[model samples]
Target: MRLGAIADDVTGACDLAGRVAEAGLPTTVLLPAPPAPGHPSPTTEHHEDVFAGGDDASACAVVALKVRTAPVGQAVDEATAAAQLLLDAGASLLYQKYCSTFDSTPAGNIGPIADALVALAGADGTVGTPATPGARRTQYEGILFADGVPLAESPMRDHPLTPMRDSSVVRLLAAQTAAPVSLVPWEAVQRGAAEVASAIGAGHTLVDALTEGDLDVIAAAILSAPRPVVAAGGAGVGTALARAAVAASGQRVDISRSQLPEVPVTGRLLLAGSASAATRAQTAAFAGERHTLDPLALATDDRALDRLRDALAARADHREPVLIGSAPEVARAQAELGAERAAALIEGALAELAAFAVHELGYSHLLVAGGETSGAVTARLGVQRLLVGQQVAPGVPWAVARSGEREIALLLKSGNFGGPGLFTDAWEVAP
Candidate 1:
């Protein structure tokens, strides 16, 4: 594999994988194997041959892990194993993909996990940024900006899991890792890769990137640095990495796997579990039959699951697309059942609903929003890997995965990604 990406979440993995695929490199999203006998994380030895059935050399392999909100020690161990998996798969470049918003608590899964990957690669240092210009997320002067406003003042500050109250990337990362955190100013970056490389030292350096041009420069510098190239950033970096790899190796994207394939859009079902403003807007703008999941009802009532199943059955009978998600009153549910419990309840319920829509109802196309929810649904459906396909939005795509004997088309979207019309417009563009 040319690029081995370790994403902190499932949607983020698909986001990065899609970017790589767009750059002419076939990409695969691999989920970690089931946990060992009594272990919580899968080891490198245990995950061998994970890429055996997928694209080998000249392709990108991304290991998606649901460790974005996991505890520190556990997150580090799991991310490190994924790093080892990519390295063992003969990936010369290792990219750590996280949310474009740099979602994390003061006690991080990002900082510590990046540190683990760095140590494992035995690299002198690394350059990192979360500037995905396509998503309107950029970094300048070491501060992260979303849609022209600082991240602290954005909607992400109200995020239930990892409320990003600080806009300074240097400070956010420095608070979680002992390594010296520094910045490579836009002045240096604009001068080209050599200037950026010269500013990079023996620690984590944050680079400024406000546009695609800046990303290409940064990617070039990272790829030409030295052996075992290790870098960390959002999906923007993944796109740049693929372009750089192709330029250096002269490998072309496998055309057969890059484009959308002919697939039936019958039995379409849209399941969303994110409380993000984008998803709420999408749910409201959707012009179709829909059902709202009530966390409180699901937690306390026995008939809630039955009602949801029945709703799916009705949708299946008509072969119509439906949007099913929890109400936007997550705070109220969290207040009553605690944050973790409420999240688990919703994720579990959505996973079960996805299984029913597929296995029981014969749904062929599944559109899922949110990271944890996508992870749960994929796990419940027993999907081991996903082949990157046509994109529906900036970071969301329609990929194919197998569950038993069924070929299911999945469109996994991050909560903060896509437009308000996504839930409705996605169907019009499906292959």
Candidate 2:
């Protein structure tokens, strides 16, 4: 059994899963949700059942965990608890979700967790982390062993984040174990997938030709290959990507979304107007209806923002997905409106979405309109990134960036590209 685990925050989970599936590996992911301290441990029985159904249960499973920023104490505890559970479950390989925000400080949150996991898994264990110094705007040296050996390290160059830095420590640790190491960059993964597909079409070793960010392309390349394909990642994005991978491979593949069901809605409602216009529309759109709220609305000053928050207090309430248009402009306006006001609008929107997901909608799926909106929304939600843009086989967009945990999938078109289809592609909508 070649088991692989991806430990990361929510956004990273999706990105990694998409890449892994692209690599043509059967994979599973353990995603993070808001902590439920009093609740009993969720069941893994279903996962086991599913794995057993596979030809080689032991050989096929890969688990990825997305780590979130928690109180230093709680983060350590959660990591330890998760590691113990994986060990008990006989997980073959484990990867820790590392980030500058949580793991960069001297007394960082993930170090303790990684140490604990190493102790638990011994030689079989691997710790992985992403280098994200730019997004966090802070710096710290990698941890050292008692014998003066550095744990693990990987560079964060070309990652789609601001003032980029390296997330090499965890990768270094994983490499030390000589376990199958994966370096995940939001754009690299997708691009790599494309390249691998081209290579496979030309003839190459499935493993030898594999490189960082080649998962998606490799999976696509191996569509006709003899090996079984597995796609997995965090809940929402993972589910979508896995679906795409399965469709692309023309094969039956196993995948899972977040256990938390999302609030359902009807009508592809598009929220338009200025930031304020969209904000005003969001309140009315979801007032009493049961629908998913788009996290991007947080970037605007919508009048309904407050009302939506109030409505989401009850478990039965659900709001419609609020799409925020012209997000880059809105963000700029908000900045001019002063950080406090800007944050308030964004915060209000996020609070509404969170409440609705946890209570009313049960964590529903929502899509943002633009890359900027996707970035802003996910950032406010404490997610590092959200996979934006749709893939039409081999068509590559003009711009793409991967921030710390966030990824902005942008599809840009020139004014002269095409009169009508340009707008459609920009919005990732079918023409």
Model 1, poorest ten-residue lDDT window? Answer: 49-58
The alpha-carbon RMSD values of the candidates against the true structure, listed in the order shown, are: 2.1, 13.7
State the C-alpha lDDT per candidate.
0.85, 0.34
Tens digits of per-residue lDDT, candidate 1, 324-430, equal: 98888889999999888899999999999999988988889889999999999998898878878767888887788888898888988899999999998887766
Q: Assess the local accuracy of residue 108 in candidate 2 as a C-alpha lDDT between 0 and 100.
A: 44
- Residue-level lDDT for 289 in candidate 2: 39
Candidate 1 structure, TM-score to reference: 0.95
> Highest TM-score among the candidates is held by which one?
1
